[model samples]
Target: MINKLSIVKLNPIIIREDRKNYIVEDRKNGEFYEMPNPAVDAINLINKGKPLGDIEQILKVKYPNEDIDIIDFANQLLDLELISEVNGELILKEVDQFGPTGFLWIPESVSRFFFNKYSYIFYISLLLFNIYILLTNHHLLPNYKDYFIFSWMSLNILLWLGIGGALLILHEFGHIIAMRANGLPTRLSIGHRLFFIALETDMAAAWKLPSGKRNVLYLGGLCFDMVAFACALSIQYFYPTGPALLLAIMKILVIDIFIRFIFQCGVYMKTDLYFVIENISGSYNLMENAHHYIKSKFKKEARKAGEAVYEEEKRTIKSYSVIYFIGVLLTILVFVFYSIPQIITTMSHSIDRLSSPLFSKPFFDGAIVLVQTLTGLSLLLYSWYKKYRLKKE
Candidate 1:
């Protein structure tokens, strides 16, 4: 129970997330806890040496009978480790202010070239030309599976993985560059979203930027991906298949990158497009509200949650709930009917290749098979872990 006399201060580690919300980062455990806007404002006042009574009085004047309990809010912040008590008073911890900007830091100097608006226009124009050439030359286009030249061998898969990994790095750079273009500093790190390992750009700071710019920043990754796919397509138009292996590589790059591009449309998966819609609609809590609204249709327990949502947000959430439901249903159908079966088949085929008599004789080839098998297995396990065990960290 934080009382009026108890002096409290905001933990410096608790970052102001977006334009309207806050999130506390646990440096020790790599966790993020989102905070409500009101409590965050009170913490800001508290950090300025205001007593709890003063904070309560100020909030009372500001909100005017919103029934805000500063004491309870401050207690919650304490429980969340967003503020710490030191000798009857909360104190802020001093840490390196600009240290550890996520797993991969993008310094301004190297990334400056990417932030240029003129360069974006050039890149887009080139991509459009590439796409035009690709669409018209349908006869030269290879089948998607034609890229699997060695029947899922380790070396071939590794080549594809290397290309995909490089593209992912550029994809993240696109986000950083876009943020920098808007005169915003960005931090990025490697993190997980369910079963997927993802690059997290700390766009929480972008909340202060115009919503239009923020939306473009959210799309930066896709922008890079499109450029990559275009480059691969361009190569296809020039080489056409004279080099044999070049065609396979280009086809692989084109196909894989395009698939990843489509992955952005996965609203149920909270992909980039989801954030775009959320930001564009000004519904910061769209996902949470949408989940409740969708659930309330059939689940009695969710009715209160649906009711608790703000009226303005409810319209956006309700509309989004329908889209969310459709997206989820389609994902389930695709995974259950095609994706799971294809994976199982690939694993079986890989096992057969590894168990062959020739595999035992040539150590290198066998090693490749082993790597491919382990990679597949690791992804499966990661997916399960993400769905069942992973949370916020």
Candidate 2:
């Protein structure tokens, strides 16, 4: 039995279902939103206060050919704040703003054609290329020192590094593929942390899709990285003598992949993980708005010198204290503990290399080290600037 009061508490989307298409009307604005068949049905069922299980059963009965996971579908709806649960009763919630609708511009035809046609082949080619490199360079494994020395002076090092960077772009594309597969539009762009890295795909649209789709998008990048790692591992297994050289390359690849996953996928900083947390918290823009609200408090205090403003500030402060504390703690852990140690160790190693006699070709080695250091420093400065801007905003 449905709770009528809870159902009444929700603002429902008025959906007109036709054989060909489904149209959703925004009750407040009197604007109609058009969507394909399945999404229309899902939205209607949710609005009717149908339990997720019952809705899935209905969808399965009507569209027997379509494979839909009810739980995942339900979670997606929940994440978008289109539905809510009140005392175990499912209810619909009307969203005032739909966030950015840029995802709507991506055509389904383009998504289907590009992803379905190219993803598998792209992944396979990448794996094979890495394997080929390992095999060809097997003899050069024992002379890793020589290769490193040559790499310092060789223009080919830039070419090989470019190839490595391109592979990372493909890795981001894998994420876009999975997101598109789930009927979500994604924005792909180049993002720099401290160094100009490969590319990044914004799967923020995935949050509006079903939970299963979000999982695919989140895990897809890691899956591609794992595939590349597996191929590298296979090369190492077949050619054991060049283990050290292979291992070093593998370490760089794995670390880069893992760091991106942690920072971009981890939820604490409003990346993919943040979306997941929003889903779990039943607060769509909790972190985003919470940060804004906290900033507003400070602004209010600065602008209005009144006890009322101070009291309001205290209330907003109290509302987000726990979350803010956790964020600060995590920042300390990552920066002071993890990143600081890595930066110190890298600096120490670079200084030691600069002074070491191993750099017989002083000019070449010094230049290589200098270039690497400068690039690293530039990236660090850029990241700090970006963070500062984000905080200011």
Candidate 3:
């Protein structure tokens, strides 16, 4: 319904400049779009109350060589729900905000208290203390036996699951608080990264801030993990003669923290550390570009990654491609050498235990493991459905 003389009324929007594109976000529902220079110019003119025809003429003059289609651009804006009205008639589409809402009450001061320079110094010092503690007392280092803290395998599995679930909440809380401190709201939800189920913070709004300012949001979870690790080590060091169960719990936490830290290094999974690297390197599409680079190596005519960007991005993409390939290869190797064998051995043991008399210790143990396995698979499937299938529909 847009014509040359149509005066477009745009919905309220917050526009911020990214490195090469402008981010146009609807203020009400938080929907955003990344637009290049020309499109952004049209938007700016629209904001200034220019008629669609005048905006088209201005853009045509700005880019004389390119085909400037004002009607097409206006239609695209309409599709995005950016256009509230044309010729003063309401054409706005109401949209619900994406993700879980209601963290607006969290004050920025709380974030500053937790994430300031002095707090980071304390965290770094604590991490160093932990390293010293481990080095001096080699027995403090993580051991596989730590996983079997309880007498019953089922109890031990449940213990880890309970503790891990709690810690995961803490980890995600770090992200939420950091985002809130920056005056941005975020929500946590289940997501799948490859074969793993992960809790993710929807911080897409963080892009409104400068890349340098956003690193803290990415590092927030890992920071909490580091602090948790240090606290566990400190408890073990100071309370040598503490209650037996408390000491055992600390030992379990120590190993869990170690595993969590190592797991975050899995850049292929887009873990916290991956975002840190991405922010530092300014490789906004590192994973996608790396994928393209890897694909190009196998097929000659494959679309090259980072061809249009600066040389620095190209280098980051090339370097990450190598890391991505090795990471994936190592994952496959681990699955073949460790995970598969472990799953098979656990299943075999569970089957033997299940053959025992009803209500016996062995039967209960096997039943617990089976339940845990099924629960894990169910969660994985649910995560996949939520992330991909549900989104598509």
Candidate 4:
């Protein structure tokens, strides 16, 4: 177990330097560790094929006043499974690769077309066109009634789920494709953001990219959402009296896109917009820091909390606290004004339909509603458990 002569072989590591610390990333698993100068120097020596003894001597000579522990640092790396081998023996651990699983067939050149400077211009143009259409054709703006396209509640729910699910996939695909274009790995997963279930792209590896490049990746999903909304609006604008079924579906798409946009605006939850803001501001752990800052205000620990964050990030986090509260207020407003009313109306209608004759259409619709409600509650509870209790245990 002694390590004076131990030669450590490391797995692929990518180091990114921010204002405060060196973010040492285990590329194989997308794990990151914040390390100080000494630790980073030790890592550099290890990469240069220097034995542990040499590393210790080098670090000790370099930082004469500081107490440096190369062996302990190597052990920490070992625990993280970043060590690939020791003196010719394999030490790397088996773990799931969190890289791109789909769309590998698409070349980087092709995917890059979507995020190039010109594409952003197109995205903005389309967004403006959609706004113009909405302003000119006020009737096309989504109303709450647009959500109830079908007479049967269950049918409407099924239709929306089908279309919304597709849109969600496209939204996530935008992120995935953009990531691949940047020669990075990411995958889509489901997670809860407060009361909502969202499809998210795991872009932990994105830290390797420059902050400017990462903004494109972060905004990828929203860009696709805007494109979809614009396309649907354009079609409806040109053919106002199109086939009834097609027009009805377009109306549902508009409502789905509109709600999703509003949902992303509530950045208190980890939305795509939140990542963009965090990336552009160069603020690490903005969400957690902003949260701490807000709590500290009431407890009079604002100074302490402020000190805990990086010096460069202090001002940004303080400002972000304001945005965080605004986002929370937006969520509260949506919950009170839209969600509560929708829930009450749906439940009341379902209960009334449940009283209808057995095996009738109304009774079936009511049964479907009950099942849907129970399923949604189950998913929400499961998400909460997975996020909190399961992780601790």
**Candidate with maximal TM-score:** 3
Worst 10 residues of 3 by lDDT: 303-312
What TM-score should be assigned to candidate 4?
0.85
lDDT against the true structure, per candidate, is 0.67, 0.54, 0.79, 0.81
lDDT of 1 at 124: 78
Model 3 per-residue lDDT tens digits across residues 264-345: 6668888787888777776667887777766776876664433534355667787776777666676665556544664565
**Which candidate number maximizes lDDT?**
4
Q: What would the TM-scores of all predictions be? A: 0.75, 0.46, 0.86, 0.85
Ranking by TM-score: 3, 4, 1, 2
Q: What is the lDDT of residue 75 in candidate 4?
A: 90
Residues forming the 10-long window of minimal summed lDDT in candidate 2:
140-149
True-vs-predicted CA distance for residue 2, candidate 3, Å: 3.8
Q: Rank the candidates by lDDT, best first.
A: 4, 3, 1, 2
lDDT of 1 by residue, 1-393 (tens): 568877875555545465445655554333455566666678678877888888898988888857789888877766665676633554554443432244234455555566566766876786687667767887545444544677545666577667767877888878877776666666866555444456668776565455566777887877777777777787777766558787777787776665555456558778888999887776777887776787788998787666765565777787887778777766565456544654565555666665667636444555676776577568767656655654644
Error of 4 at 43 (Å): 1.3
Better model by lDDT: candidate 2 vs candidate 3: 3
lDDT of 2: 0.54
